[model samples]
Target: MKQRIAWITDSTAVVPDELREKYDIHVVPLDVIFEDGAYADGIQLSSSELYEKIDHSKTVPKTSQPAIGKFVELYEQLAEDYDCAIAIHLSSQLSGTYNTSKSAAAMSEFPVEFVDSQIVSYPITTLLLKGISLAEQGMDYREIAATLREEASKNENYIVIGKLSQLHKGGRLSNAQLIVGTLLQIKPIFCIRNGVVELFEKVRTEGKAFRRIMDQLDLARGIHKISQVEILHGNVMDKALELKETIKSKYQDIEVLVYPLSPVLGVHGGQGTIALTWTNEPKSS
Candidate 1:
């Protein structure tokens, strides 16, 4: 059989409910465990469900990647139908899912192509979606994966962490720092660097943090064309909407999309955090 291509990604894609079935993309679920048993990220639990869990549990829930069986099963099934599978995964710095997928692919009968998105949330999702688009246009698997990685590496993500309390609960910050930052209403903005999450900047107030984020957008667009943009938030539709409008006005021709943050990300940034991701340069094959 001639080689056919298919795309696969993790649940962080936050794929619009409207688009999943239309595309031949697979969204593998992550794992979350609380006081009792464990459940898949979106199959058995949702973001709202995670919020409730966080409220009642004395300790924050733990998260894990999908089992190796999950990836192997998908690989085997897709191998029968397609020439090879291009599996794009979340950053190895953030989770072990990328490595897990790597291990699964080694044992699978089919040749599985895996990529470390090196970015998180919709940034990586955008890369996978774009690759899928190209694949639909008859792009080769290896070419698709390489293009996806190149484009993803040129992307940038900015997070204006709305609350320190959430990071504290998620164990990203210590009690003393969280308490101090929360007391002073300080917000920290983070950026992804070379596959690792790092501290980017800090602001004294939410207003400044948001303004700085917008400023970065302007600067990035000036340097390169902004191909894709996503605004990730918890429940702050108003803030996200405001940011969207600002983006639309400033870059009238750019494509901008917004969606809620996934539970895994929401846990660390807290309810009102706003994360913006966009391509910093044009992607060429």
Candidate 2:
């Protein structure tokens, strides 16, 4: 008998609307909690609304992965219709969403395949889209899982942080380091290395950071065949557009897409952060 497959992702994936509808991807939202209130990502609070609250509030907000109960409920429902489900989530190094989803998957009756994307934002979205495409082509669950794992190993993600204070308060960075960087007016660049965020370098300004990111992209393209490119930012569409144009100009054959970083990711990246993510195209036979 043929198997039916379903796709699941968290809110931070940043997938396009048309693709989501076409693939019938399910999104489980995270929670963003302020001192005065709590909101579900993409459900009760939008990126702009969350940023507005952050700008006005005296304190920074915190984010949490969807509760295990939410995942269990979703999987139970999906199992009712689909024979199995494939769940793609953010990096385990960046968030606990993967673990939560894994636990929920174990509890469900149907066979559910859980993938730790080892990357966040648009990179994660790109990875999931590849898996969804495979599924649409009638690939079985095991074959699809193998393809996703191979594709995920080629991902590279980098972030340009606009403010160190927010990241420090959010616990991603040390306070002492933030103070030292602030004293020197430094802008930090971070990259996902081995599924964890690692400091790549610190530049004197954001412009230099963007230049550094472009330089890295150029280097990677020289080494590998890039399949997709996504530029993500928080409340900075103009700069994102300019950067997108710069990338498009350089790689005329590939189209560069720009999107806002989801509010859950924005909470840690801060308001003005911009991230560049891409994956190598799979080799042809």
Candidate 3:
């Protein structure tokens, strides 16, 4: 009998809809809760809906991972079809989803290997996409999972907030700084280094921010081999499209794909923000 393998990831991965179905990837949706009500991340608040709601939200939207029981149930069903299952998730430091995934795996009656990605959005999604390709190629589950862990640990999440208004509203940034940024027309540049989001730079305009991000992209490695570039945004279609064009113009050959930032991320990135999700070369390695 041929060996079988299964792939899983959280909603924050920002996977393209067509690829999800094409790869048969199991995407567990995150929970988006408003004071009025709650709904599944992708299913309930489509990308368009998420953006619309974000612009009008007076209160911060809450996010929750899939419960242990839900994880166990999904694992049980998939385990029956596959000889081994590999579950990948966001940073354990950022969210409890990774821990919950591991806990559910331990409780499962079948073999469910959980991987802590330590990265979010496109970086994690890229790892998952690569892992799924390996699995589909008849690689062993352990090999695929180990490769994903290695790649994910080295992935860099470079995010650019076209406006600080969203981060300020979410309380991630102070009101005073937010006001100054607004007056100065500041665009905050950030990147996830060592499992945490760190400020990269502060630009006075959004146009320069785009170039700065692409300049960083040009400096980075590992992206040339990877054909797909994932763009995650919060209520910023025009900005996303413009950035996509910028990427194509500079790279000339590399294709850029945009995916809506899930509600889990919407909590941190305010409306009208652009997050470039891609992997980078380790300075040490």
Cα lDDT tens digits, model 1, 167-225, are 78778789899888988888899998888889999889988888898889888877787
Better of 2 and 3 by TM-score: 2
TM-score, per-candidate, Cα-based: 0.93, 0.93, 0.89
Q: Mind giving the per-residue lDDT tens digits that candidate 2 earns over 23-56?
A: 8889999999999877999789988898899888
TM-score (C-alpha, index-matched) for candidate 1: 0.93
lDDT of each: 0.81, 0.84, 0.76
lDDT for model 3: 0.76
Q: Which runs in model 3 stand beyond 4 Å of their true positions?
A: 221-227, 280-285
Q: Give me candidate 3's TM-score against the actual structure.
A: 0.89
Q: Rank the candidates by lDDT, best first.
A: 2, 1, 3
Which pairs clash inside model 2?
Answer: none
- Mind giving the per-residue lDDT tens digits that candidate 3 earns over 1-285? 556767788888877778778867888888888767888878887766765676788866778878788888888788778777788888888888888877777777667677778878777777777777786687877888878778876665567775576666667779889888888888888887767778899887887888887777776743444445778887787878988887887676567888777776876776677888665443453
